[model samples]
Structures are given as C-alpha cells and as structure tokens.
Target: MKVKRSLIAEIKNMILQSREQAIRAVDNTRVLMYWNIGKRIFEEEQAGKERADYGSFLIRSLSEALQPEFGSGFSVRQLERYRQFFRTFPIASALRTQFSWTHYKLLLSIDNEAKREYYILEAVKSNWTARQLERQINSQLYERLLLSNDKESVLAVARGEKVPSNATEIIKDPTVLEFLGLKQKPAYYERDLEAELISHLNDFLLELGHGFSFVARQRRIHLDGDEFFVDLVCYNRLLQSFVLFEIKTHKLTHQDLGQLQMYVNYYDRFEKQEFENPTIGVLLCADKNDAVVKISLPENNRSIVASKYQLYLPTEDQLLKELKSELDKLDDIN
Candidate 1:
C-alpha cells in the first residue's frame, strides 16, 4: 500500500511539471507567431509602390477587415505598429522570448537604431518587464550612459561585451529626484531630503542604478571614544564593495571628502570581508567645488566619488550643454 501511494505522488508531480512546460512552449509559440505576422505585414506594405499612401491605407483597411474577425488586437494603430515591427526586426530569431508585443512597440518608438539596440539588450539581460523597459527608455538610459562612460566603453557595455567596474560606471550623477514626489525648489532641509529618500527607498535605489542594495541609513561607528555617523551605507553586488555615502545639503568641502574617506577606511579594515574589494565612498552634495574635488583626491583614486544631486530632472538644454562639455574634454584628450 505504501509503495503504491508513493508512485501516485510521483506521477502527479510529473504531470504538473509537464503541464508547466507545455504552457511555456505554447507561450513561446505565440510570440513566434506574432513575429511572423509582423514580418509578413511589413513585407506586403513595402511592396506597395506608393509607399506612404499605401502604408496608411493598408493599416486602415487591415484594421477594418481584421477587427471584426480577429477582434481587439488588430486596431489601426496596432496594425501600423505591426508594420513598423516588421521593418525594425526583420530577423525573427532575434525576438526575445521574454518580451511581449508591447515591449517591441516601445523599442520601435526609439528613432535611433543604436539607442534602440542598447535598450533592447539591457531590457532582455535584466529580464525587465515591459513597463520597466518603457520607463528606463523614457528616462533616457542611453543618454545617461553616454554621459558617464567613454563612447567605446559605453557601446561595449551596452552590447554586453563588458561589465561595469564601479558605482560611477552605472550610477548617474545629478540623480533625478523628481520621482520621489518631493517639491521642486521647495524649502527642505538635508535631513528632510534624507527622510523622504528613506520613505521612498526603492525608487531612490532604482534612480541610483544597478547593483545597489541598501545596508544601513544613518549608520554610526565608534572609534577611540569618538563617534561618526555615515548618512547611508550600501553594497554594490557587481562592484563587490561597500559604498559609503555622506550627504550634504550645501556645497561639498574637502573636509566632507576626508570624513567619508575615514568611513571607507574603517569599513575596509573592520567591516568588509577579505574577498571583497575595499569600500568606496560617495559625497552626495547639493553643490560641488570641481577645483577642490580635483585637488583633494589622488590621480589614481578609484574608491571615492563625489556627485551633485538635483531636486528635479534637468531640462534638455542643460543635458545638451553637459554632453557638449564632456565631448569637448574627450576631443581634447584625443
């Protein structure tokens, strides 16, 4: 009787596992079907000699014909998107199984091929949901990468050929805090900002970029009868190091860097494991003194970074100016 019961249980488990596998296979097939459909529609539309006029009429006619028979999926806009879908991704094998048709729609909206490719690779590699992919693309992930890394390195990383080494590699400076629901140009204290960040910690971490895991906030350490408090402590799994943060509402000073360095030294000596890299420190200030920052750190310094933070996302004009300045510097080096 016992032997028979065990056999029944095993059989039921096998059946359940088989059912899940079947479901996944069907889902994958559905994705392939859509890709093929998009490809067919695109080719037909292109063969229309009038091009623009034919393309518009094709979508409108297809929507009218298919909507009644095929139902809600074939709207005029969706038909147009399908035409674009075929145009953008002529190769069906490259369509990611994890993403839905909605994901491809967002990618299609990106005008630049290079930028679209970057977002697609990142979204697939990260296993981001459609909404997350849309948000990151809309948030200008490619633009941020261009600002932070050299063009070659940025392309390499986007193509998944290279992995980022440090926080600065992935994290954007002047982090856009508008998503935190904080007032723009409101009278707020540093402590108030800290409180709001803690309240919206998950959003802050996303804005901080990949690999950051929260450790402690307002962490205190005791040494030789003196106590020091670091504003935020985080661990970057990719970098394999502890990231110490010191937040200042005002302009950064050399002393702020010194204080952060002390925290990093303490973490390196006592807190971090032998296998991990030395701790890194970040000075998150409302303003920064570039001359002081250049003089305060050694030329080869890798473990400390200082970045300014803004209450709001910068305008396109500001972003363009910053980009031009950075490009100028790179040109000078070359």
Candidate 2:
C-alpha cells in the first residue's frame, strides 16, 4: 500500500534475501515498471516517430532486447500496450498511487473520452480497488447512471453540485446480481431473492448506486388492521428519502407496481419528515414490460419504479441494444 519503492533491478538481489516478501515486492515493482516502460517507450517512439513499419520495427527491436532478460512481459504486444497506457494517462505524477496497472489497463479499453475520464475520477473519488473498478465497468455503471440523470447531472452529482430527486437517478434498472450466487430459475421465491440481497448487502449497495444505507428487512406496517410487510427498506442520503424495495421473482405486473407504490405512500405519510423528500419505491422483479411500468403510474411519477433484476452481468451487445433503445425513446420525446 505504501508508494515507497525500490529500483526494478533491486528485485533480483532482494529475491534471494526474503522469500516471504518477494511477492509483495514484485507487485510494487510491477506497477512502477509499467510507468517506467511506458514513459521510455513513448519517448523513444516520438524521437523516431514514423509510419507503421517504423513504429513496429522500433517496438520489435526493443522487445528482442528486453525479452532476453525480462521474459514475456516485455513482448512487442505488451510493450505497445504500455506505450498506449502512457499516451492515455500521459503524466505519471498525475496518476493515483493506489491505482495498479490493472486499473489503467481497463481504462484503456474504454473508447469514449468523457466516459473514460468519468471512470478514472470516480474510481479515485470512491477509493475503488482494481477489481471493484473492473466490476463497475463490466456492469456498465456509467451508462446505467446516465439512465435517470443527464451527462451534466451525473458529473454534477459526482462533483457535489446537484442533488438527485428521482429513483432512477440512483437506482439501476435490470440490476446485476452475479454476486448473489444464484442460478437463473423460475422457481426461486421472493423470500429467496430477498435473502440473497440481505446476505450480500455490500455488493447490493454497490449495485444500488450511491448513498444507500440498509434500514430494515420485512418491515411491518398496519392499515385498517390489515398488516403488510415490506421486503426491504433503505435510505438514500443524496435523495433525502426512505426507499422501499419489494422483491418479485416472477414477471412484474401493474399490481406489483401498485403495491410498491402503496408502500412509498405509507412511508411518506407516516415516516417522512416535512423537510425530507417523498419516499421512493422499487419493485425489483425478474422481468418487466417498460410500457406496462410506464402506464401503471401517474403521468409525472418519479418515485415508484419497477426495475427488473438480472441474475448475471449483461454482455456488450445487450448493453448497446439497451442504449440504442433509450436513445430512440429520447428522440421520440423530443
């Protein structure tokens, strides 16, 4: 965790001194080596910069020279990757010490410049490790966050310049539950899904976006001597409201949305303070029709939502299709 580092050459000598510390030392050495390699390669490439054949020739010669001593990590392809890393990140001084090469490597895959910058800044702001950053990328967090909020609003929320007033601003529809360790099946009960969410509260919070704090499970209420149990309760600091979640393992229906809406109304009427916003309700179901969900609520409704929960992360094609569909809807509205 310490940025205090040694020369990469010192590894060969220290490898013999401490067998136990070798792995940790090598990890630190590897991170430093990535920046050093990238900076050197970029400098060399710029000095003799030319067309493809020349660039290829330079990298290949460098690889052959370093491969004899450093192994496959210095192969031509990897060397090129390091060079690109330096090009993308530019200055090593501006880099986060906590970010390992793994994080930068992931960032390189993102093509959109604003999207890439968002991930980089968010990773540092949230103190995400490489693995956590990868998960967020894989989950397409940036795009999902934009579903309820605009690009400027998303950045504003990140920068503390705005407060989100809607459920979709912070809640992801079709939320991924790969961490719940559940197999996709028709027979899983609502209780089973709720249990998995409770067991994996931390991962669920990440999936739920930001400012979510778990409040209660199977929350009880009374209406005209009829008892109703809410599946889960949470509070969002940014929204300044209580969020009620209803788990539905089956395909979502208007009735399901209506039921969750009642819970939101209950919380707002009985539990919320005058300064707090209205309560939000999320019907986390396995499947839903967007049209049905839309028509089930008031014309200006922003609190009640029926969000389908996925058992696994969506593939790139699926995410693209979803984005295109959203854009089409926006075009229609405009």
What are the models' TM-scores? 0.83, 0.87
Off by over 4 Å in 2: 1-32
lDDT of 2 by residue, 55-135 (tens): 788889999999999899899989999888878878767876667778888999998887888888778867787888999
Candidate 1 segments exceeding 4 Å error: 1-34, 50-52, 67-73, 158-160
User: In order, what is each prediction's RMSD in angstroms?
Assistant: 4.5, 7.1
Clashes of each: 0, 0
Cα displacement (angstroms), candidate 1, residue 126, comes to 2.8
lDDT per residue as tens, model 1, 1-334: 2579888999999999999788767766766776677777777877995666887787788889999999877898777666677778887877787777677778889988887887887777667778878667656667766787776776677677877776667767666676677766734687788888889887777777667899999899999999988899999887888988788888899998888989999999999998998898988888898789879988888888888887776776777788898899889999
Q: Model 2: what TM-score?
A: 0.87
Model 2: per-residue Cα lDDT at residue 316:
77
Ten residues in sequence with the least summed lDDT for candidate 2: 1-10
Clashes of 2: 0
